[model samples]
Target: MTSRRLFLSTILAGLTVPALARAALSGAQQAAVDRVTDWMKGLKTLSATFVQIAPSGALTTGRLWIQRPGEMRMQYDPPANILLVTTDWRLVFYDGTTKQVNYIPVAQTPLGFLLARNPDFGDEVLIRDVEVTGGEIRITAFSKGNEDQGSVQLVFAEKPVELRRWTVFDPGGTKTVVTLSDVRTNQDIDQELFVWRDPQLFGYPDLD
Candidate 1:
């Protein structure tokens, strides 16, 4: 059985950031970061279909539901048998294959800053690089005081300022790229989507 801790550790171990000889965010870069932060904080709810490519190139498809200020659910497709959710203070992982649930303190995960009440580009997260290419804004950052935890790169489409995809690089230099499609924002998402239930009891059906 693959516990959540083991899974997370496998992807998030031995990560380090190389110091870059760069100055503070330029005026344009700062504006772009602020635009993204402002857009992110204004999002109350978001739902989308996602394709996640793991470091080893394994792919998983899922539906993602997010409610800001600390709530989210990533429900994987068949054969994956995984559900990752976040609450105010914890990150929960449900394994449908083994009917086991794992919990980790939110503060220990990069998700903590992402789901914060006011996710900004400073302090909690240090914006490392910002670029604009083909009408898309790419912002990369690492958790402050814990750069070894890994890094997050967020890509947004401009004109409408929509989040298109994000890539997470774990400590071992393994990258997980998630691309979003069919996104619906600020919609009324059901509270139950964020709730954790025993898959064997009434949720996901087990694979025989």
Candidate 2:
């Protein structure tokens, strides 16, 4: 797979699974899951700087903007020349180097959970594990019926429970880690950021 596709597949994290049983969770674990769910539901808009470690261990930096119930954008720094935008239930990926654009349904991506109007630990998403340590909470999960498609672990700070980072484990056992910094939540984000203008058609502009 191309690097961008790999990155996306890792993010998708096997949302195509047919059916699987939900893991049993203790009361505390259930509470933790609820907290994260509630937090995501309350999050309307967010902007952050992110550092992503690809499966090959290459590190890249980018800016991220998110508007819940269906919009997000990630723009990589120079040399990477990549942009990922999610809007209208579809993910549009633009490769500046190749001047190519590809679209995939948002429902196929793990991000669908975060973009959902009301995210819950329901049958579509199963909590594989949960851990609390060193003032952080980590929740690991995967789509039902497909343990082989890999899992995603979201790390959050305690106390107020803020999202810090997330790690995606691909089917081949490779992992991608994305850490967020300077995160601002419930802030106004320019709606244009989520707009996907095909660079191939419009001529490339400074996307940053």
| lDDT, each prediction | 0.73, 0.78
Q: Residue 28, candidate 1: how far off, in angstroms?
A: 0.7
Clashing pairs in 1: 15-171
Which candidate achieves the best TM-score against the true structure?
Answer: 2
TM-scores of the models, in the given order? 0.86, 0.89
**lDDT string, candidate 1, 1-208, tens digits:** 2544444653233222443512288899888878888898898988899897876677878888889878988888878778877875687878776778778776566555656787876655667789988999998777555545567777999777888988777766667788999999999988877776666778753322
lDDT of 1 at 116: 78
State, as a TM-score between 0 and 1, how close model 2 is to the true structure. 0.89
